[model samples]
Target: MTTVVHEFDWPDRVVIGTVGRPGERTFYLQARAGKRTASIAMEKEQSAVLAEMIDRMLDELVTADDKLSIPAEAPAELLDDAPLDQPVEEEFRTGSMRLGWDPRTAQMVIEAFPVEEEIPGSDDEALDVAAETESEPSEMLVVRIPVGTARAFAERARRVVASGRPTCSDCGMPMDEGHECAPEADA
Candidate 1:
């Protein structure tokens, strides 16, 4: 799995030591000659077998010990995209504040987060007693929003509520009538 190579040069010869594999086989190679030595993994066997093969190969070849250096000419990367060009305005969530995109003007509209409260008394059973009905606040909110993208979000909410039951603006969770979508009764 792991291969190690060692190269040493003497005044007269060089000695190299290495161990690892030869493709599908395992072996270590050691080469020693006049003034040069290099070691590397070359086969599937003991270093002795590798040395015999390496000795035969190195004995006939021209040996050089100098290492040449090459440099890359490509320019370094620069952060050319980012610039002081825009301000931070768009946001995902803002507590009770809400906004939606308007296709007409490509802007945002402020929205009213509808809030509903239940009757405290167990007066639900008194539905038959029409006169006993309690008065409730108007669920519709008509807050004036500045002209721009922010105002568009609210206009969309108003349209959606006027259309029918309201749904979650973020995830499209349906709020059916008499439940999540219901407005406060003005009874």
Candidate 2:
């Protein structure tokens, strides 16, 4: 099958957002440029990790010899707190992602691939069947943003990930309305 790439370069907006309540939220990575938009469903962990990795990448760029104008923090003007665009249609569920830096353009590139559809069969049969088929994604989302926008995107992604269910102070696990913490262990 031919892969459809939703490419966005120097996008007008890109962010990680959620739908539903705190404990039952579904995370999505959305990118928009002009009238074109692409949204992909992802796990909360993925969103958090993406933000962290972006931050780490930017931090490393700050110390590089290239002396590119990397920002120490997201510029106030670029901080985007707006909710995701209307009609947030998910193109696919993300299975894997790749991140890279383009030195020539001073841009961060993000590519997300869809999860492979599972074949109906036993484990061994599934593996055999999968091997017969082409091992490539049918669709992908490619987004490129400048350094400052990348910083802002990372910051907002982190906030969205953290906005989920509050954690138990004692157990360090997510807590619902009636969640109870385990007692402290004796030294």
Candidate 3:
């Protein structure tokens, strides 16, 4: 199997932003390294999960070493509604994501796996496809951002997620414009 890796070492900017209104928002992660830039599409859930993971990691790092200046929240002045760069075609739709600390490079590595769409029907056919595809390596997007920027990105992402439509108190699901929840459904 061939492995294709796209790496951005010490990106100048890495941020998560949305393209539409609360309920219909499309989250994207854009990283700029040197002259090349990469923008990837991810679900809102993925963004929230990534932000939560980053936040937890930053907290752990700060706790482990009191010297790290990772703040709980980014400075308000630093947060802005920056638009995604031109040619915003998604490099890939994120299927899975991971975060790691590289001691050798002293940088945090964020890797995102491309979404794999499976054709559903017969189990045998699915296994055959999976086996066939197993020989082909999937593309992964990797970015290394500064700790401060990572923290800021997490904070901004948290805000963006919270800014979504209000949730139904009973079912704990997002409420649409005319969302109706039945007492039985709540249970």
RMSD values for the candidates in order, in angstroms, are 37.8, 1.7, 3.3
Show where candidate 2 strays beyond 4 Å.
Answer: 123-126, 185-187
TM-score each candidate. Answer: 0.19, 0.93, 0.81
- Compose the digit string of candidate 2's lDDT tens values, residues 39-109: 99999999989999999999998887467889889998999898888888999999999999998999999
Ranking by lDDT: 2, 3, 1
CA lDDT for candidate 2: 0.90
lDDT of each: 0.28, 0.90, 0.80
Please report the candidate that would top lDDT against the real structure: 2
Candidate 1 segments whose C-alpha is farther than 4 A from its true place: 1-98, 127-139, 142-187
- Put the candidates in TM-score order, highest first: 2, 3, 1
Per-model clash counts, in order, read 23, 0, 0
The residue ranges of model 3 lying beyond 4 angstroms of the native Cα positions read 75-78, 119-136, 183-187
Candidate 1 C-alpha lDDT tens digits along 59-122? 2221321231111111123111121112322111111323333335332232322223444566
Selected candidate, larger lDDT, 2 vs 3: 2
Report residue 143 deviation for candidate 2 (angstroms).
0.4
CA error at residue 112 for candidate 2, angstroms: 0.6
